[model samples]
Target: MKAEKWVFGFIFVFFLVVTPIYWFMSGEIAGTFVLGFSALLGGMIATYLGLTARSFDPRPEDRDAEVVEAAGPVGFFAPQSMWPFWCAITVALIFLGPALHQAWITLVGVGFGIWALSGWVLQFYRGDYKH
Candidate 1:
């Protein structure tokens, strides 16, 4: 986390310094905007990691150690389900909106995607998986 924070912080500073120069030299607004926005987001991420890492002791990786226990599973993961496939289908339909010349299909896909996402999120609320 410390390393991440420092790397992102460095990138943020580099972008901040180069954005104006890029805009002035190339007269291209898109690249300037992208660099500036990336810097802002990177800075935010660095700040979040910096603050969060302050609460914990350094890890084996931070100390450059080769400890096997440190590579253990962090937590259990949920079993896979079919909602992601449906979501992918919906996204594909939405992505093809312009090519298909049909916005209605995209809108319907968005609705279906939202419904599928909700079902996926609440899957454990009932039935055999209830908790």
Candidate 2:
């Protein structure tokens, strides 16, 4: 977490320096917006870090703590998943369909994507009770 703090500090400082350089070079209203946005983001990050600094848990003193092992596998393991393949195909079509002016193909892709996602979700609930 010390590393994270340094990283955030560096980013905040870098943005502070870059904002003015960008504003001077671009001379555009968008540069001002970017500067303001970056400042706001940096402030928020700093605030979060300040508030959460004490919440980080330190490592345990005993390095050889006994860990309890589970009796068996915890959850369902579905063997087959064609849904992912279908979802990937759907995404590809959604990306390329608009360029080809195939609106219907895009709609079909969206439908297929939804269907695949739903099937994947339902698979979690289909396990037998092992106990």
Candidate 3:
């Protein structure tokens, strides 16, 4: 995490320095926007790492340990289902709607997408997998 923080911090600083230099050299608004946005992204990553570091101790990966111990079982993982396939079909419809200029199809796609996502999220809350 500390290494991640430093890497992002370096990127942030690099962008900060390059943005002005790029603007002065090219005088292009688009270049400045790109550089500024990149800097903002770097800052966001660094900030997230710093906040996360505060919440938990360093992990074996973070410490560069020669031999890391197992962290133990993670949690229950949901079994595979068909929701993703449905979601993909919905996405295809949504993209196709815009290409064919049909608003109704796009609306239907969005509705179905939401339903599929909801079903996937609650799949384990009932039936055989219910805890």
After the best TM-score superposition of candidate 3, give how far the Cα of residue 90 lies from its true spot, in angstroms: 1.1
What's each prediction's TM-score? Answer: 0.70, 0.61, 0.78
1-131 per-residue lDDT for model 2 (tens digits): 44455566667777888888888898888877787678768766776775676686532322333344323466756676677787788899788789899898899889888988887667656555222
* Model number with the top TM-score: 3
The Cα local distance difference test for each model comes to 0.86, 0.71, 0.90
Estimate, for each residue in 1-131, the C-alpha lDDT of model 3 and write its tens digit. 99899999999999999999999999999989999999999999999999999899787778766553636777878787888898889999899899999999999999999998898888888888887
- For model 1, residues 1-131, the per-residue Cα lDDT tens digits are 87888999998899999899999999998999999998898889989989999899888767777788498788856677777888888889888887799998889889888988888888888766777
Q: List the residue pairs that clash in candidate 1.
A: none
Task: State in Å the error of residue 19, model 2.
Answer: 0.7
Q: Poorest 10 consecutive residues of model 3 by lDDT? A: 64-73
lDDT of 2: 0.71
Candidate 3: where is the Cα deviation over 4 Å? 64-70
lDDT of 1: 0.86
Give the root-mean-square deviation of each candidate in angstroms: 3.2, 5.8, 2.5
| Candidates in descending lDDT order | 3, 1, 2
